[model samples]
Target: METSDKVIHAIYNDDDVLMAAVKTVKAKRFHIEEIYTPFPVHGLDKAMGLAPTRIAIAAFMYGCVGLTVATIMMNFIMIEDWPQNIGGKPSFSYLENMPAFVPIMFELTVFFAAHLMVITFYLRSRMWPFKKAENPDPRTTDDHFLMEIPVNHGNERELHDLLSKTGAVEINVVNNTH
Candidate 1:
C-alpha cells in the first residue's frame, strides 16, 4: 500500500495541547492511527485506550520453561551422569542437596525470559537493527507532538479543524514514502 508515501496530517507542539487534542479525537470516536512525541507522556496510553502490554505474561512463560529445563538438565547431569556426594549429602536428593544449583537455575530463568522477551518485542514491533528508523518527523524527537491521521474520504477538513482547535502550534501534511 506504499504506507510510507501515504499523507499524514500532524499537529505539533506542547504535550498538554496534544493531550487535549487526543482526548477530543478519542471522545468523538475518531480513529487515530498513531501519535509521536519526544518523550514519554504520562497517561497517554490510557487516553489512547491502548491495552496493557502482554510481554510480562510471555516473560513469565519463558522463565517457567527455562526453570523446567534447567532443573531437568542439572538433575540428569549431576545425579545420573556423574553422581557425587558432597559432604556426605545424598546424590539422588534434589531439594536437600541441590541448593547449590539454585543460583544457576535462577540466572537461567532470568536470562531466558529477558532475552526471549526482547526478541519477541523486536519481532512484534517490526523493528530490526539494520532497518532505517521510522521517524515521521525528526523534530518530534526534539520537541514536538506528531499526530498522524490516515487519509480517509470526507474526514480531512474535519480532522484539520479539530487539530487546529487542539492548539497545534504547527500542522503539516506529510507523505510517507517508504
Candidate 2:
C-alpha cells in the first residue's frame, strides 16, 4: 500500500456501534481494508469478506517436511552410520516390536512444525523484533472498535455521515502520507 492513499477510519464507542457500522459498510458495497477491536467480534471477518487463513496449510506442509527429515535422519543414523546391537536387540533394523525410535520421531516432527509455523507467521505478517507496529488508534487495544475503509470511489462526507449514522462516536480521515 502506498503512503499517499487516503484511509478513512471510524472509531466506535461500543460493539453495537461496531456491528451496525460493519453491516452498513457491507451493504453499501464499500471495501473495508481492515478492522481493529479490543477483542474479537463475532462474524466480523465474514462481514469484511476476508477468507479463512492459510496457516493450517503452512503447518501441514511444515509437518510433512519435518516428518520426512526425521525419518531419513533416524534411518541413516541408526541403520547406516552407526549400527549397534543393544540389549541383545538386532542391529541395522527399525524394530517394529520395541518402537524406540517413534518417540524421537514424534518429538522432532512437533518441534519442526511449531518452529517453522511460527517463522512462517512472522514472515507472512512482516512482524519482526524491534519493528514498529502500525496501530493508529491505541484505544482499539482497549475498549474501542475501529473500522478502516479504503478510499477509492466513496465521498468523504457521505462515508462520514454513514459512520455517524451507525453510531460511530469519532470519525477521522487518516492521511497515510502525511
Candidate 3:
C-alpha cells in the first residue's frame, strides 16, 4: 500500500483491452493498485493474483449460528418454557416437535447468511455509510475502464510505455494521496 504515493492511471475504452493490459502488467510483475470498471470484469481477480475469498466460510458459520438460535428458541418456547398441547399433539420434546420448527430454522438460516454476507462484503471492501467515495475517475462508472498501477522504484516511464502499448486511450501519472 506504500506504493500509493504515485500511481499511473490507465484508461481503456473496452473491457477486453483493459483485461489484456492487466495481464501484461502482471506479467511484468508490476503491482496493480486497483481497477475501476463500469461492470464486473470476469476473471479480473485471478488476473490480479488475488486470493480466494473466505466470505463463504463466514456465511456458513453465520447460517449455523442462525440455525442454533432458532433451535434453542423454539425448544425453549415450545417444550422447556410452555409445553403446548394443540389438537392432541403435545410439544413435550424438541425432537418430537422438530418438524414444526423446520420452517423457522430454514428461514433464520437463509436470513442470517444473506444479510450477514452483504455486511461482510461491504466491510471487507472498506465501504462505509456516508463515507466519501474514492473514485479517481468518474468515467469508470460509465462506459470507460480505469486501471491504477502504483508507480514503484521509479517505473513511471516503463509503465507509461507499457500501458500505451496495451491500447490505453488515456494514461495519466498522478500523485495519489489516498
Candidate 4:
C-alpha cells in the first residue's frame, strides 16, 4: 500500500472491537494501511480483503522436491555408489530395498516443506535482515490493537468520527517520517 504523508492511527483495546472497526472502515470505503495486534486475530486476513495466500502450494512443491532428493540420494548411496552387505541383503537394488528408505523420505519431505515455507514467507513479507519495524505504536505490541489508515486531505474528521463510533479507545493523526 502506498501511504500518504498524513495517516490516522486508531487504537482499540479489544479484538472484537477492532474487527468491528475494520469492517466499518471498509464499509465506508476507507483503505486500511495496516493493523498491528499483540496476537493473531482469526479471520482478520479475510476481513481485510487480503487475497488468500498460495504458500501451501509452494510448501507442497518443496515437499515434492525434498522427496525426490531423498530418493535420489538414497538410491545412489545404497544401490549404485556403494552397496553394503548388511543383513544378507547385498542386492544393490533400490526397488528391492525401498521399504528401508521410507523413514528417510518422510523426514526429508517434512524438513524441506517446513523450513522452506518459513523462508518463503519471510521473503514474501519483505522482512529481510535489519528491516525497520512498521509498528506505529508501542501499545500495539502489548495489550492494544492499532489500525493505520492513509489520510486523505479532507477525511480526517470523518475518519475520526467513524473510528469513535466503532469503539476505538484512542485516535491520532500523525505525519509519517519517511
Name the candidate that leads on TM-score. Answer: 4
- Residue-level lDDT of model 1, residues 1-178, one tens digit each, is 2133445556567888888888998997777778889999998888999999899999999999889989998888887789887778788757765688999899989988999999999999999889898887788889888887765655667777877888887766666544
Best-fitting candidate, scored by lDDT = 4
Candidate 3 residues lying further than 4 Å off, grouped into runs, are 1-4
On the 0 to 100 scale, the lDDT of residue 50 in model 2 is 87
| Candidate 3 minimal-lDDT segment of 10 residues | 1-10
RMSD of 2: 2.7
Model 1 spans with C-alpha error above 4 angstroms: 1-6, 176-178
Q: Any runs in candidate 2 off by more than 4 Å, and if so which?
A: 1-4, 95-98, 152-154
Q: Report the C-alpha lDDT of model 2 over 63-154, residue by residue, as the tens digit.
A: 88888888888788877789877676676566542377778878888898999999998998899999987888999999888888867655
Clash tally for model 4: 0
Query: Which stretch of 10 consecutive residues in model 4 shows the poorest summed lDDT?
Result: 84-93
Clashing pairs in 3: none
